[model samples]
Target: MTAAKKAQGPVLTTRALNRATLERQLLLRRHTMKPADAVAHLLGLQAQNVKPPYYALAARLDGFEPEEFSALMASRELVRIVTMRSTIHTHTADDALALRGLVQPARTRELNMFRKGLAGVDLDQLVVRAKELVEERPRTLKEIREALLERWPDADPQALGIAARCSLPLVQVTPRGLWRQSGQVSLTTLTHWLGRDDGQEAVPDETVLRYLAAFGPASVKDFQTWAGLTRMREVFERLRPGLLTFRDEHGVELFDLPDAPRPDADTPAPARLLPEFDNLLLSHADRTRVVPPEYKGRTWLGNFAWSVFLVDGFLAGVWKLAEDKESSTITFETFGKLTKAQRTELDAEAVRLLEGPLGTGLPYDIRYEKVVGA
Candidate 1:
């Protein structure tokens, strides 16, 4: 059914999609938008780890300082939570509640896989207890799990723990997500953290528009894959009248806001260094717009997303950053030969990164560990 649908839209080139992805992502050029605004604009930053959100912003925002971004977390204007894809994202307080509401069904459905462990356990009571435990003070997941086990002694310990996660809109408390800080993830209810009623329910209509603005010229499958939900074609259909549509090389129908930018195929996309698990690499069902087909799965190693770099607007290499008291180093492990011009661009970008958001008051160096084909 999906394939058949892909064969139907008006044909368009992938380069158009590439430039649009970069532009929508703010990689078409750096912007002066505030970090909190950027958090809302991109919907949220993929935050499987603490530092990615900072690096993700550094790549797309002009004059982005990690301190400014981190300050939002310190101020609670931004928070880290499990949202789309059941992965942690750094989101504005309002987006946190609304998106959680939007995906509540899916998060709840995640519990079905643990049904065997949840058997005979009263889930409604579990929600109440879990909410109370966290609100009294932020608690670690292990602590939450053990607490659950105390009540449901006979239930699968792991299942009870997961149920607690699946059943709540828990936010990872501060010191956990703040930059340059190290702390275990502690959970609490979003309402408790924000001191307000949960925001309006996640409306598919609003989410559809936002998704297109950030990730579109995309297909339904792309949205589902990024959102960690399924069966959303109905939402797209309802919005079709106002949206402009195009087809990819595979004839996959893509939708976008009517006035969205669709640059010509020959536009020059500058080099960018993106942090691991950046949404740009994960948001699309057909990632060929940013990741070439030949490099499929090259971005990972044993379930880890290597910090990747874009050359000419596609995943061209992966990079690693290492810092010590005496110096900081940026290393590139390329996937293919890079031209002299590309190397110079990578060099300058690395320095801009190290001195700007990453300044450590230490010497900086750049190396090419595996410039494939070089």
Candidate 2:
């Protein structure tokens, strides 16, 4: 029976898959990657909030400083834009242009869903006018809403603004995503921000290869979930010749790049503190490899995703940070118990976080609760 299974091919257990994912995510060990380079490699960091991307790079990169990333935002080398999953992501300037076009069909579907609110509004005219408003100068959503209302006063005020977002490749300008800075979400076209007229669109076939390089051993369903697109099985089939295949323990077929790293099942993975909505947990349809089944729903609270912590490359706990004018404190609350040695390692990691990217120019401390909610 063992020989028969071997003849079929290797079956990757959950642990093996977890290690491989961590390595690709740069969570297995800290790397000395440049800010723009890392953003391009991870596809982009989930930037729903300003600090998550900074805190994320802190945990994944060696000797990372917040200013290193913030400078990229200021230079227009990296941008915060609505792209994958229809959520704001910190993407490279090139990606901001290409991916916007790649996922445009999904955005069109999103705009169509609000047609009831846009009964008389012409989407083609809306796109042209929105491009003018933002390219003239960055405009806040309130400004855009009011501008649209002038043209379509009876249209649902909120829906008009959302429709504009869905139809345009708007980017959130600097000082909003810059580290240790605050500003309202102001917008502009990617072309205006990057100072280039022509941008190459992201080839979906090429994207499959890039996705596999960073988040592979994935199924077509997993890629679809991450890209927020569908009908990708055809693409996968086309690329199958250059890929390798293996079955997950559940017999689900997984595809990976031929030379991508596939770590052994028992490889050591240190504790990692990940930002809220990190792709490591969200990029796959079946999350069991990174999120143990029992901990389902623990990392979220009524639509909010808390920053999470990993012990041995699996979701073990949730963490929160509290700050005042004088000091900052980070608290850890694990869903499962840890060994004495594990506790020691986590303590050190928490301190590493305080000293690194989170250097808020204030005194710092760490705290641990006996239970997750306590």
Candidate 3:
């Protein structure tokens, strides 16, 4: 049998996939890499909410100071922009530039979904005018939409706003994503914000390799889902000679970089706290690798994505923080029974999360709430 066939016979069990993913995600043990490096390695954190990236890096990096990430944003070395499913993410400046062009197709699809609402509006003019407004200075969505409406009063205002966002490479300005700081979501063109005169665009093959490096041994479907781009089978096929392949227990073909980390299934993974919409949960087509089926649906309550924590590298429960002037409290809601030892480890992790990355410097409490349905 060929080597590929040899590697395929043994099915990778769920726990095996779980352990391998945890190791790749830096959740098995914290690494000493710089925060920006960590962000790049993980292919950017799912950062619809500003604080998730800080919490995500803290969970994956050793001695992580929130300021390290904030500093990158402050220096424009890192940026927060809409990419990968057209959601806000904190990406290294390099990624913000390259990946944005690659995902333009996905953004165009996003605009198509609102085409009915955008009838009678000249989209070409909208893009030009939108660029003009924000390129001058960062403008709030409301401000941009109101201005667009003046020109296209018969068009759907909401659709006009979405059109601008979908058409432009808008970056959420600092203080918006800065730690412990709050500001309205403001936007400016990536070219203006980054001051890049040289033309650069997304390279799909490079993006595929990066995805594998961070969240891989994944199926093409997994990648398409994470990227919000479709018809990736051809891309994977083109790179097949340079990639390694394996099969999960369910017989799905999985792809990976030839030299990427794939730790032994028995590798130990510690407890970790993850913010709402953490990339780990959202980056896969089959989340069975990181989320047990029993606990899967619990992460979402209606439309809200709850903050969560991991025990033994698998999602154990959902978490929320309640804070007062004097103290902060973490409310952990578990889907099933956790061992006494797991609870202890989770508590310790929570404390570190609050005092360290959270930087609250206040006394805190961790409370457990039993899972209602599960």
CA lDDT, every model vs. true structure: 0.89, 0.87, 0.87
Over 4 Å off in model 1, which ranges? 1-9, 371-374
- Residues 1-374, candidate 3: write the lDDT tens digits: 45447347456778877887787788888899999899889888888888889888888889998887898998888999999988999988888888888889999999999999888988999999999999888999999999999999988889999999999989999888898888889999988888984646767888899888888878899999999999998998888888888889888888888898888887778889989999899988999888888776878878689899998888888988987899999999998899999999998898888777575889988899987876
How many clashing residue pairs are found in candidate 2?
0
Please estimate how well model 1 matches the true structure, expressed as its whole-model Cα lDDT: 0.89
**What does candidate 1's lDDT look like per residue over 144-180, in tens digits?**
9899899999999899888988889899998988889
* Model 3 lDDT, residue 299, Cα: 86
Overlapping backbone residue pairs in candidate 3 total: 0
Give candidate 3's root-mean-square deviation (CA, Å): 1.9
The sequence of per-residue lDDT tens digits that candidate 2 reaches over residues 1-374 is: 34225225578899999988888988899999987888889999999999999888888888888897899899988999999899999998888898999998888888878889999888889888888999999999999999989999999988889888998889999899987789999998888988995779999999998998888788889999999999998898878777788888998888889899999889899988888999898999989989999898888888799999999999988888888899888888888778988778888887887766576668888887756352
Model 2 steric clash pairs? none
* Candidate 3 TM-score, C-alpha based: 0.96
Q: Over all chains combined, what TM-score does candidate 1 have?
A: 0.96
